[model samples]
Target: MSWEKSVRRVTPYVPGEQPKDKNIIKLNTNECPYPPAPKVRELISGLRYEDMRLYPDPEASSLIKALSGYYNVPEDQIFVGVGSDDVLSMAYLTFFNSDNPILFPDITYSFYDVWAELYKVPYKKIPLRDDFTIDFTEYYGDKQPNGGIIIANPNAPVGIYEPVSKIEDVVAHNPDSVCIIDEAYIDFGGESALPLIKKYDNVLIVQTFSKSRAMAGMRIGYAFGSKKLIKYMQDAKFSFNSYTMNRPSLELGIAAIEDDVYFKETCNKIIATRERVKKELSALGFTFPDSKANFIFAKHDKLTGEELFLALKNAGIYVRHWNADRIYDYLRITIGTDEEMDKLISFLQKYL
Candidate 1:
């Protein structure tokens, strides 16, 4: 049998390739090159085989408690999911009704559009400004009724961030519908929109352990919102998958949260590396958007994004290339260790 009409219209999201060989410098995905905190490894190592036989806690109480303490939000205001992508998907399902269109930036995480199609929700893509920054004026001027909004902070590929105040202004103006701030990369440098949740019942903030905490393999993400908003997400979660976070991931997520020092240090290192990379890229006649995430979006006047991406791949380094209309010339390169970045710079100097 053929797939449904909605599936026919959908273009699936393409994640960065995870190569089998460990030799490649994987700078395509914005994953931390560093390992997770020692405590997380220790906890995972100590997990009993018996725990695998039983089902994980459906509520993931300990993880929720730890996150509540970490973010200073109440436990009832939190909802845990397999990953921030999962959380985003749930939010799409939970908040966006079939009658109203969902709104997001034209050049965003890309998955946002996919999720909308998967859920059969109508959507409007608001284009970014000429300089690659989001124009809130165009977004809110649409005057759509009963629709929701989602934007990635320090937004993917572009790596530019919206100030917390700007996000607050948007939420204040749109009290009638949900406003989701996907902070998947916020820990790198962007200020969180979590504080806005206290004032706006419509605000929902999504975060993950994958990037900052070096827990991509664990697949743990959580959302913070008003109790009423979180309840709807919880209901959606129950309907889709009652227990998204497994036992080992749950335990290690708690450990990762408890070890705040490790998390901060790792994130600081990535930020430092990012700054250095930006400086070096500028010196090479490459212009990039101001970055607040672990990655940078850069393009050289002499080269196309696809050309640079292919050259890097040939040098055993992988970076992401977007051929989307306005951003076709830019490459999204993730920050790795000092040595790895040095290698990348050296390669670019010769190639460009």
Candidate 2:
């Protein structure tokens, strides 16, 4: 069967590989090395199999209320999805139109580009500065109007964060268009854009349990914005899949959100680990952006990113490698448990 021309043109986003070996020190995906709060496990264990007969709360009300209280936003202003990726896709459908072109940093979460392609929306990629930082002046400060804007706060692959104040300045100025801040990795470091949502009706902040919350397996994510904007996203979600979040995920998400202490403690640990990794890499003559996220983007003059990635893989260590322009030599390595990181460093020391 033939697909629609738009579907045919789309190239789906490639997630990090989940290798079969359990012994491998997996650092390719930016997943939390620690287990989610023990409450999540308890919650999951308590779930009855018979509950599967009924659909999950179509709106995930409990989780929404929990998030509302957590973010200090009203329930009407929050919407949860299978993952932040779902919320992002819904944003593309609900806010972006074919008439107005979408704009985002060229070196950002790859899924943003995929969404643009999937929706057949016109988009222009504003290149990052030579120093690998987002140049908001070139994007929003210019007179040109865009259909919508999406940016990863601490952008992926590069692992550099844009200040929340700078983001506020840009969103404050762009009142006419939808501005989406994908904060999937923000909890690790960097300020959340949730505060700006109260001030800007056009701004939408998407977050996920996959990263900081250690709920990637639960496939839960959410978006915070004005009630009106959130309603539109809800409409989009219902139009596509009313019961987008499953029962187990919904319950686990609630438990995860409620367990703030575990989340904060784990995040702090990851932050410390990230700094240690950064210092070690820098000492080895490797250059990397000062990462605020749980990962580091490091590259050495003596070896290519691909070479290091392959070498690490051969040594039972996994990390992410992208061949994009100006970043081809860098490897994105996730901060894992202290023991896991030590193993990775040992492998690098031996191989490099």
Candidates in order, TM-scores: namely 0.97, 0.97
CA shift of 12, model 2, Å? 1.5
The weakest ten consecutive residues by lDDT in model 1 span 137-146
Instruction: Please write out the lDDT profile of model 1 over residues 1-352, one tens digit for every residue.
Output: 4556434566899999898889999999999989999899888769999879999999999999999998899999999999898998999989988477878889889899899888888999888888889887655624655488888898887999999988887787777779999998998997898998888899999999999999999999999999999999998889988978899999999999988899899999999989988999999999999999999988888888898889899999999998789889999999999999999999989886
Q: How many backbone clashes does candidate 2 have?
A: 0
Clashing pairs in 1: none
**Candidate no. 1 TM-score:** 0.97
Across 5-39, the per-residue lDDT of candidate 2 in tens digits comes to 53456688998999998999899999999999989
What value does the lDDT take at residue 84 in candidate 1? Answer: 92
Best model per lDDT: 1
The local lDDT score (0 to 100) that residue 190 gets in candidate 1 is: 75
